[model samples]
Target: MQYPRKSYRIYFILLLIISCTGERSTNSKNNDSAAHNRTRYFYETVKATEDTREKIIYLDSALASIKNSRDTLLPLLLDYKIFYHNSLKEYDTSFFYVDSLISLSGAHRDTANLAKAFYRKARIYNYLGEQEEVFSNSFESRRYYLAAGDSSQAGRRTLEMALAQISGGDYLGSQETATEALSLLEQEKDSVYFSSVHNIIAQVYHERELYNDAVPEYRNALRFAPSLSDSLSILNNLALVYRDNKDFDKAIATWDEILGKADSKTKILRYEDNRAFTRWLKDSTQDVETELLDVLRLRQELDEEIGLQASYSHLLKYYLDKNEALSRKYSEELLKLTRKHKNAGMELTALQNLIPISPLPQTRSYFQRYIHLSDSLQMASINAKNFFAKIRFDEERKQEEIISLEAENRIQDLEAQRMRTRTLIGSLIALLLLLALSFLIYYLRQRFKREKIREVHKTESRISKVIHDELANDIFNVMSSLEAVAPAPVVDQLEKIYLRTRDISRENSDIETGENYITYLKAALTNITPRDSRLIISGETKVNWSRLQEEKKIVIYRVLQELLVNMKKHSGAKLVAVSFAENNKFVEINYSDNGRGLNWKRARKGSGLQNVENRLSSLNGKIEFESREGKGFRVKILIPS
Candidate 1:
């Protein structure tokens, strides 16, 4: 559907207003102490004002109060600070506050609170262009959210991760992540988050050029976003999709709606110009001169109002194309405006125009300037691509660490619950003495079972820490340094050595976490090169993750993890592939690596490989590994969840 251009302009204006305002509300305070009470009061007073200036005053007052109070108030104060800093685009300051909140949450053993801090940190990292850090922090935040039983946040984190993947050009990965996040949001009845998930789904579809599928998802985003502001941007994007689909009428209708809601005079003018241009382009026999004149006039008007250098350059080009006089006037205006903004595109355009119009004495300087700007723009594009790749790589690695940590936490919770079950059984036996002697013996056995669980949890915790604390940190540090230095490809490969070391560390943990686990597999894959890494992920049409028993899910996760690990460890070939096929009765996973094929007949099964076999066996699953001397290894496992 076409959105009015007015909608787009109105949305930005509202966004600006929101960005400028701040407040601290007393209602949000814990109400635990007199100081908290006062702080809350001060906050609410500021927040109550609709006036932007008054709101700022309240924020400043609240901030001062928090700074003067006990150290206990630091988290509260920093939270507000983060809010304002983010609004102001002070990302560095915002991140510092988020980090402080995380540390405080850790000190207090507040897992849920810590998760929020981490989530904010991830958001800041995203804004700062630190894609890897954003992924890692977001993963950690999701882990903590799950730990805190905050399923909504957990689901949102998944959505955010999907966005990260999409932005990194991992469309397949994004599709999978979006599917998972959507399922969670649907279950939670979270309209806002559900809308976000749908938006990501649409984005993935769009990125993959699957317009047929994307259309429905975009419609879903509009359905859920009841607010005009919330839906406008997506509406604009949908219009773009229609434009891509060559549905000119539909695209124009969408733009019409955007124009309807536009609040700013400047934006409305720009929108009119775009619409006019699009319309002119669509008509085969349109008068080019008339169109050019219209566009040039629009640019001149906006240029004077907003100092838009691009418009000035555009006007200069249009005049030059017509071989008309007054090119010098536009050129001079573009140069003056470019001096203030230093906008590369406008500057480049101006330089190119100057190449043709320059006085005989200054032509060389114009050419040199053009060449220099072109090179800089080229370098910038290269840097952007590399930065995007690094973000994707880092995010995937961070996800592994988060999964491992969550697994350990889940093990501990299960152990605790088992202990309680045993205690209850024992107490019941105590009431019946002789008649319950058999029951008492069973109770004792259950206690032993619980103790076994505790032991297992302890082992898992150690392994989780190895990856979470030791390996993740080391690899992250390496990623950080690499980003800081922008090394050549050869140096980049050497830096990747640290990433390989991290893989080994995660692998070492896999021996205890169970073979073929998702976390282990993901970690192993992140360590390998794209040329060497193969990814195949498939599942049932609609797997009910929440309904499945935890142990069963973990088992499936582990099986896949182990298979991938072995692939990375042994696969000499550059290709890896995975496929999931399901029938009415069973789900099958096929993992293949183009490494030295494993010979099931001649291979000596290590403890880790054997353990994978055993876990699958417990689930009534069968495993097969087929590999020949020069071929790659392929492992197929079938199980029911």
Candidate 2:
């Protein structure tokens, strides 16, 4: 059935994709016998069908259930399709599938499959008699197979290409290709292909009419022949070359060996005919007619068309001078056989035989017929080459278009992925910058707190030095003068004032900013506690006081002291508690008192209490005062230790 051109292309690509993907899946995971049997069913069905259209129909039917499936035998199905089309000489359709194989294999980078595709292309070109294309395509197949490390296939393709070159009369090129094939196969130790390469080289030499040069190659081919059938075939070829070289003795002797080895009647008759013909050529007086005629009759009876042509040519040559009418009769028989087979070479030989024997009136007609047949063959060969070339060119252009579209799609996909990657990178960079900014803010705030606390320490140190060094010294000197000259009440009052000045100096003294700091703080708190009020310190051992900064430690010590002093002087409370605790994130200290509390809103801030608020604020800590007129005066302090 006919279909639109687009439909065929679509179908081809679908098959190509399915086949390659399925082939890979099969290699990796197809172990089920049922799946293999299912594949076998389809593969055998299509392969067994000889008719091209019928095979394609069977292929379509088998593939009907294969829609978008990972069928394990897709490659087999494609192989049979190519096979059936090639058998029918439908090279265009065959080429279509081959190019699809190339595209699919290339898309997946399947080196072996690409070699197979080129091999099929070269074979089709061989059928079209386009030897140039055959050689080129075969070379490509060999190159790919070699790259895939398939030495046997590489050698086989090279030898086949060499044969193509020889057929096109490129003797030197054929010799070189054959030698390359030999090099490839020898390493593999493949006797079958090794012998084939030698045979190809021998043919190349024979085609140049260098019988002496061809002898050794043929011998080499015979030496490497792997099987009995192959050995006989090579022997028969060797004998033919010997006869063509006019070495009739050797040719007859070679045929004797062939006849001895022959197991079938057909083989015996063919060998006997060749031997008799060779002996007749060697000695024209020999009575070889009976044997030659008998071979011809037997071949005809057996309907062996090829053997009949050979027999007729032999008889015609033998009778050409002695019996004109008999020679003419044999030539006519040969011509009929050649015509039946449509073998242009055999027909040309037949026409050449008839030309010399025909009557004068018929001579020109026979010559004209020969010339016409030769020209028709030449024209047909040229036409076939051009036709196949045109198909290849058209297919290649379409292939290029398909490749361009696929490339464009791939570029688009890559661009999209790049865009996504860029976006993700940008997001990561932004998140990093945000984290860095947060860390910078935290560092600056901590630095500011530390500097502020240092300033408070420096101020307190200056005040303590002034009281002890300058003020207390002047008071002591005045008291010493009053003790000697002033009234007793005046001297006594000045002495008390000097003692209070010394007490203020001691209160503002430098703090111990070390491990002994907590001990010093506890002692100061206990020393200041009134006789009536009790001081309680809990959870102090739980705090890792050494981890806190020196300035923060000093501040904590001062604040606690101020609170205890105020409580002793004014609060008149029974109990005071200072608690410390450490958690995963922060160190915490809670100071609370149960004392007679004044109205918190109405209470004025004394210098000492205000000093406590300033100290806590500098360290990023918190404080709360809770008091009542008739209830206990309570102070709650929270310092981030």
Candidate 3:
């Protein structure tokens, strides 16, 4: 009772002071209410099952909180922005939010926040297809993660970065990333991140054309994802890779295992996917009717109209090669599918396949159809590019607007006092007028200079095209005619002259666009490679040469052409296999011959050998020649992609 009297006296004095000040009741109460609302909203937004749906709700709550109070909850608002951009695949916007959060975090210095920022930046760079930027930011993220001493979390990010590298076609880079991740996750044997490392290694192997090496890694990934439904597709891809490596027995057995586990109630999509592989395995024989019937059965059971058309297209090629009566059956099926899908690309493929097999009278009609479809598809691709460009442009514009607004606010604050002065405004006006006059003069001069440059470029382009087309064509034709004449002293001299002229023509030709490289290579090889037998040019035959750097790609193209020519003249090979592997760091050419093995000593004096050596040397590449006395010849050439 005595202590209560003293405490009561102190409490009365404290309450009197608080009443006199009276500032906290309104502000603190409002803040508490706002915080309560925000907490409720945050929980409600985050409660969704789906990631994208949750992100949408988060964004809505964030926008609402901004309306109520932005200064107190800017950090969460920034997080919301990041989540929104990530969901929408707007990576740059996500990066901006991350950066904002880092700056706002102040003395707290959130390491996890910085890690996330760096990761987001890496992801953005990946989306923009900037390889250097992707690696740089990914490494930066790794550094931050390392500094934070979060090895497991760092390993997961490393795995994701490895996947980015893989998608960018950097197989070696991905392999390194995967190895690093594997080392980090080694202690955690049952960790999901460790499983990802295995999958990434498989992908890297797949990209490097080491399908055999990929099998076990994929199998390991499957083990980790055993009960997870997403693993099914990856298993299918692994099986297909096995099949590609001609391990069909294993592929079939694995697929059978997949089918056995697949119940009717599992999922329709999974069943359909399994059916595609099962059908593919069944058709891996040389029987056209049997394959066609299998394809027809697939069409009956599965709702994959597009896949059925693809099978039919393949069958069309098979029948044309076999001269089978079932050609018309597949062709009719293709026509039906094409009409249903109205997919220009698929329609063009079907028409092209049908063209060779259709009756002679029907050939022209199919050719016309093919041309129309191809043109439409090309136009659609162009439209898509334009659409993407427009979206990118709008994003850039929005970013610019935000930058300008912030700058404007800064400038307004700096000039807040000066803006009231008419004298200061007059002085600024005079300075601006002088600047404008100078800018006008500079602009006129630059415009004139650019116009002059344009004119010169146009003239050069015209002359180049004219010289390339008329003179080169006429000289090449004369050289062809002269080669047909019997070899003599003068004829040999003339042939040397022809070879020199051809070399000059190729060197002087356009390397930048290189649109004619593949076409010219095709023509040159056709003239040189034996036409009397089967030669297969597989693996995305219609590659856009413009995607390559002119000089290097031309070197590869010419090298392949020379290889084919040598094969025709010397190898006596019946089957020629030419493979084009487009990848990051290197584009490889695999040319194999089923002809007699090469004699290195004899080949030393060959002109074709000399030509290949010269071309490969110019491109800073080397040829790996594989041949025994009797088996066959295989030449692998690698160059920077």
lDDT of 1 by residue, 1-641 (tens): 12225543453344334334455466534433555566678777865776645665675565445422233545665677677777778665566567657765775687977888888888887877665566667778888888888777788888888777665555666677778777656443678877778888888788778887888999998888857766866776687677667776877787788889976655555555545544544663455456446655765765543435545554575567555456767776776677566566677777777777878667688788889888987776455445545555676677778888899899999998999988888877776676578778877765654455445545765777677687667767766777757668845775677666655555445332343344444554445435445555555334444444445555665566666665555655567676666666666778776677766655546655776887676656788777787787777887775
lDDT of 1 at 460: 62
> What C-alpha RMSD separates each model from the true structure?
42.1, 8.0, 47.6
Off by over 4 Å in 3: 1-77, 84-99, 102-108, 120-140, 186-190, 226-231, 263-320, 323-641
Among these predictions, the greatest TM-score belongs to 2
What candidate 1 gets wrong by more than 4 Å, as runs, is 1-74, 85-96, 122-140, 157-217, 229-235, 244-249, 253-267, 288-641
Q: In what order do the candidates fall by TM-score, top score first?
A: 2, 1, 3
Which pairs of residues collide in candidate 3?
none
Q: In candidate 3, how many Å is residue 54 off?
A: 10
Q: Cα deviation in Å at residue 213, candidate 3?
A: 2.5
**lDDT tens per residue, model 2, 291-374:** 999998898889888888889889999998889899999999989888987777778888998888798877898899899999
Candidate 3 or 1, higher TM-score: 1
lDDT of 3: 0.65
Alpha carbon lDDT of residue 212, candidate 3? 76
